[model samples]
Target: MKLKDLAHSRTGDKGDIINISVIAYNEKDYPTLEKLVTVEAVKKFLGETVQGEVIRYEVPNLGAMNFVMQKALRGGVTRSLRLDKHGKSLSSILLEMPLEINN
Candidate 1:
């Protein structure tokens, strides 16, 4: 299954940083989402596009996880040569990550 199967994403980017929030559709899914979405996992999933560190902040009360990805925007929307300079597509890209949760 994919992360999108359990949650949704909201994103923001500035300079070379990207911030993402993954919120569970059902509160019960938060535990699994938290376990599957880790700093190392996100770093690997996002690959070289994110040149700096990835930090995960848990929002258990809200059933959400927020990620601060450094060096992700390639110098932000104003300077990036990439099509999705603002890194808005990152939200959807992250949602595509495969999750190993059990049925």
Candidate 2:
């Protein structure tokens, strides 16, 4: 379902980009997770509350999904030092996403 339920997240904000990697415990569910963790879907979840360009990468080996959010940090490093805090919340937020599988 949610990213937190499925895996752990590591987030980094550098310059204007926010990078998040979600690692799943059960690697077998990667395919299904990938389907639900699409760039567009993540973008929708983040919404206008934040601004960024989202890119998703599949790491089947690690059973992880990496999301690169561009320009998410509005004020850059100096103005907003909230990257770590935001990252923590993002991990949990991602975990809450529901997964769908087609048989």
Clash count per candidate: 0, 8
Runs in model 1 deviating more than 4 A are none
- Report the lDDT tens digits of candidate 2 across residue range 10-88: 7777776778887877887677777777898788877763586688888788888889887676655556667553454
TM-score of each: 0.95, 0.79
Cα miss at 10, model 1 (Å)? 1.2
Error of 1 at 56 (Å): 0.5
**Per-candidate local distance difference test:** 0.92, 0.72
Model 1 poorest 10 in a row by lDDT: 69-78
lDDT of 1 by residue, 21-97 (tens): 99999999999998889999999999999999899999999999999999898887789989999889899999999
69: Cα error in model 2, Å: 0.5
